[model samples]
Target chain A: MQYPEPIARLIDSYMKLPGIGEKSATRLAFYTLGMSDADVDNFAKSLRAVKRDLHYCSVCGNITEDDPCPICKDKTRDQSRVLVVERSRDIMAMERMKEYHGLYHVLHGTISPSEGTGPQDINLESLLKRLEAHKEIQEVIVATNASLDGETTAQYLAHLIKPAGIKVTRLAHGLSAGADIDYTDEVTLFRAVQGRTEM
Target chain B: MQYPEPIARLIDSYMKLPGIGEKSATRLAFYTLGMSDADVDNFAKSLRAVKRDLHYCSVCGNITEDDPCPICKDKTRDQSRVLVVERSRDIMAMERMKEYHGLYHVLHGTISPSEGTGPQDINLESLLKRLEAHKEIQEVIVATNASLDGETTAQYLAHLIKPAGIKVTRLAHGLSAGADIDYTDEVTLFRAVQGRTEM
Candidate 1:
């Protein structure tokens, strides 16, 4: 028998999410049945609010309720050093680290030649404009992922921003904080040895 | 950095679901952001509707939008047989087979002494009342999961119903269909041997 119309609709909705299938959707729908009315209402409200209230920051392309986003608006942050990333969530990650008090620029996506995603396609033009407008900025830290597309985007950014006399830097790649040397890959090990300090 | 207010709230809501943690919730929240406006609206509506529109079937304790549920309301299904299961989702699992054309009685939960879930704590009274009220039901097929509590509940039901001259039966325990014989557990193999049918 069909799961009553309401539940069936909910299951279908849940299945649209990544990694969720028909079985998991059905399970989640039933679990929702057991939740308190207030909780269910709050959940629905949050789901709608995420889509309704949030928008990309006009300045840095980061997600925020404000047009410029909180990070973009804050005058206390180090405006001279702007960290560049592929997504707004990357900004959240950096903030969680709490080490970098600099401004941010979100690229939204990387330059993947295989996928036909070029500098023109991603959030590139705005970066150049932002740099041009803000003469105080001295450094552009390319904190894109260590993937091939990430490297390509970083190189492209360096090539363009270097001519403008602004220092362009990429995040160092090597062993992650908690990684074990025995299990480390050859390339990462090589990079770690090459970049090792005297200490 | 906080995931802006709306996305952060959405992530928390998603974490309330079974098997979803902080990382998965974050992924789902961002994915939701990427979903179309129409799809997001439908998802929110369905989430709210599931809580607002659905209720437990008054007759069988199965969840449904209707009071008696479609299974209990149907006249074409075999009135002589009633399949007993632990929860509403179990009924859906049974129906997916498309093999059973009988009415259903949901127990909501099995009798588990260890967990302090007694027969009285379950939907047993209504089931007994239904059996007495409807003399047409000639047989009961106990289809609870193959677990200790399920076995106890099945035995309890048989004891209570058999005295009324109705034929009470439990679903057979054997190697499941498409099961590899070599990898099958000893208990299941024993049941398979004991309950072997004549060709």
Candidate 2:
């Protein structure tokens, strides 16, 4: 026998999430049924609240309930150096390292000419406007991944910032991760060898 | 900074589902935020509807929207034999095989002494009463899995039903398809040898 129509519908709702398939969705729906009545009600209420309350930060484009966001408004952080990244999740990763004390600028996405994504498509205009308005800024670190798209975007940003007499630096490359020499990609292998240091 | 209070609450709600940890819950919350408003509303509506509409079938204890359920009401199926199963999913599996034409009785669960589940814990009394009230019933097939708990429940049923002057049988077993003798577990290998037949 199949689930009741509503149960099936709830299962379908769960299946919309990333990595959750039909079987997992059904399991999740049954699990929900076992939850307390208040918990289920709270779950449904939370779904609605996230969509209603959360918004993008106006200055950095990070997810926030406030327009300027906590990082952008913080007076203690270094305003001279801004780390440019692609998404809010990247901000989380950076925060976990506890290495960077500068403010951030989220480009939201990279330029992919084939996919109709250009500099105009993302929040680059805001970065330019921020740089123009904030004269104290000295360095802009392009902290994007070393993928082709990230490199292209970083190069494009460097070209734009270099004309403004601001220093632009790319993240350094080193031995990557759990990778065997035989299995490593050619580009990564070449980079590793080129950037190798003598002890 | 972390998500806003409302968004964090929403993420926490998604975390309550089975197999969903904190990070996955946050990902799902973001995915939901990306969904269209209509889809989000439909998802919430379906959850409420499932709770409101679902009922247990009076005859077999399987979940159903109606009292006796479609399977129990179908006159074309063999009413004299009942395939007693552990859950509704088992009924779906049997139906997919297209070999079983008899009716079904869902016990909802098996007797597990460790879990404080005994014969009275499941719908065993209802099943016995159904068997006693129906004179046309000639055989009962115990189609529970071959797990230790399933075996224990099957043995318990065999003792209960043999004195009622009714025939009872279990699904035959030897070796599973696509299993190698070298890789098969010792118990399964022993059963395979014990049940071997001459060609």
Candidate 3:
């Protein structure tokens, strides 16, 4: 016997999310059913609100309710440096550290040969145009993840930005702060050794 | 920097789901933003639909769109037997097997001393009333899980139903088919030895 129509639709909707399978979808569906009515209302309202209210910031390619985003709108932030990341969530991680005060450019995705995601597919064109418009930006810091596609995208961005006399730098990748050398993976260990700092 | 209000609300909503944390919720919120408008609309619709459309089957306590549920309404099913399970999901599992043709009773939960869940907390009163009404149900098969609470519930059910001249049975406990003896846990191995039957 099939799950009733409403629950089956819910399970199917949940299964569309990354990493959720049939069993997990079923569990979530039941849990949703058990949730209080007001909470469910808020959940559905938020679901619609994400699409209805949010938009891509025209200047930075970051997700925002405002057109240019709060980051771009703020004239007080440092204008000389911009950190580039593959996704907007990386900006949250950076901001959480409370260190970086420079602007950011969200690529939205990385170029991958296997996936056929070309450089043209991502939000690179807007970044290029933004740089062309703003000569005060002296540095472009690539904070894309250390994955193969991320590295490729960073390299491509560096090559393109270097012609404009802007310094292009990649985030230093090494063994994480608390990670032990013995337990560190080979690639991380190799990067740690390669990027050793002067004492 | 804070995420935009809409996306932040969406992340908060995603975090309300079981097993989804802040990071995962952020990922899901972004993924949802990337979804097509139609899929997102459907997702929100399904969320609302599960709450609005489906309800408990008053007869069997299974989740259903209809009042009695398909199984309870069916006149062809065996009237002499009733399978009692801990949750509505269990009925889905049983129906998938297609081996049993009896009606079902959903207990919703098991009796657990540590958690302080008693027999009265589950759907037991209706079950007793149903039994009192339906003299044709000669046997009650307790198909709760094999945990301590499940066993306690089964014994309690047996104790209560036996006085009414109804036979109470339990799902067999032993090693599952294709389970290797060397890999089996001690309790299962012991149960396998004790419940050995003639070939």
Highest-lDDT candidate: 3
- Residue clash pairs of candidate 1: A96-B1
Question: Worst ten-residue run, lDDT, model 2 chain A?
Answer: A1-10
- Interface RMSD of every predicted model, in angstroms: 0.9, 2.0, 0.8
State the lDDT of candidate 3 residue by residue for B1-199, as single tens digits.
7888888888888899999999899999999999999888899999999999989999889999999899999999998899999999999999999999999999999999989999889999999999999999999999999999999999999999999999999998899989999999999889889989999
Task: State the TM-score for model 3.
Answer: 0.98
lDDT (Cα, tens digit) per residue for candidate 1, span A1-199: 6788999999999999999999999999999988998888888899889889999888999989988888888999998999999988888899999999999999989999989999888999999999999999999999998889999999999999999999998888789999999999998999899888786
- lDDT string for model 1 (B1-199, tens) is 6778899899999999999999999999999998998888888899899888998899999998888888889999999999999999999889999999999999989999999999889999998999999999999999998899999999999999999999999898898989999999998999999999999
Stretches off by above 4 angstroms in model 1 are: none
Instruction: State the lDDT of candidate 3 residue by residue for A1-199, as single tens digits.
Output: 8999999999999999999999999999999999988888889999899999988898998888888889889888999999999998888889999999999999999998878999999999999998999999999999998999999999999999999999999899998888988999999989989999999
Best candidate according to TM-score? 3
What ranking of all candidate models by DockQ puts the best one first? 3, 1, 2
Question: Model 3: how far is A47 from its true place, Å?
Answer: 0.5
Residue A192 shift from truth in candidate 3, angstroms: 1.9
